[model samples]
Target: MERSVEMVVALLGIVHAGAAWLPLDPELPAARLAFLIEDADAKVTLTQAQWLSRLPVGHQAWTLDALPQASAFEPISVQANDLAYVLYTSGSTGQPKGVMNEHGALMNRLHWMQDA
Candidate 1:
């Protein structure tokens, strides 16, 4: 929920699971969060128990505290064109807009940033 090691781990888990990470800050209004969750079609949100009540209707959550034991981690085929993540704008003009970043483009930028 809050900035914690578990949050970071969950992020990496999402990346490994070949899913785009759409972080919904707890501080954001519930309405905004609901909109994002719905827009992203978020089937399962990784969150802590404290934030469960904050999630609106049509939302499902997976609490990190009750994580099941894992036996193995298998890799998935992730293409360069695959979506890396989605971030929403501030919605100064209207409702926030989702900006999608593909793996290839994100990696290209990261490589460039390292070289810069």
Candidate 2:
């Protein structure tokens, strides 16, 4: 994973073959990453082995260099209706409701733009 957030690693594992979880730092606390690691129940983690010694005492860690190369894989065949992304904007309620879109809906919107 690119970031130390465990969800990113877990999601990557689900989405990719030969996936390995790795943590990076932006001067962020290791504790935050550690929580993510534990929550994800990741058996092995990738980091500099040197930094592994510096990690909090119970978590398992490994060097990124030791990880195997990612498998050669085809990209996902996502339809336009598939989720593009969600934008969160604050409103009256504390929680945000997702606005879903389908490929046809987006295409129709684009067609209008072109005609304009």
- Model 1, poorest ten-residue lDDT window? 65-74
For model 1, the local distance difference test gives 0.86
Model 2 residue 41 distance off true place after TM-score fit, in angstroms: 1.6
lDDT of 2 by residue, 1-87 (tens): 335565455545533433333333424466655544554455765565556654557766655557566687666654655543232
TM-scores of all predicted structures:
0.86, 0.35
Q: List the residue pairs that clash in candidate 1.
A: none
**What is the Cα-based lDDT of residue 77 in candidate 2?**
59
lDDT tens digits, residues 1-116, model 1? 67899998998888788888887898888898899999977778889999988999667787998876777878899999999888899999998999988889978998999999
Could you tell me how far off, in angstroms, the CA of residue 84 lies in candidate 2 after the best superposition?
17
RMSD of 2: 9.3
Clashing residue pairs for model 2: 81-103
* Residue 99, model 1: Cα distance from true site in angstroms: 0.4
The whole-model lDDT of each prediction reads 0.86, 0.51
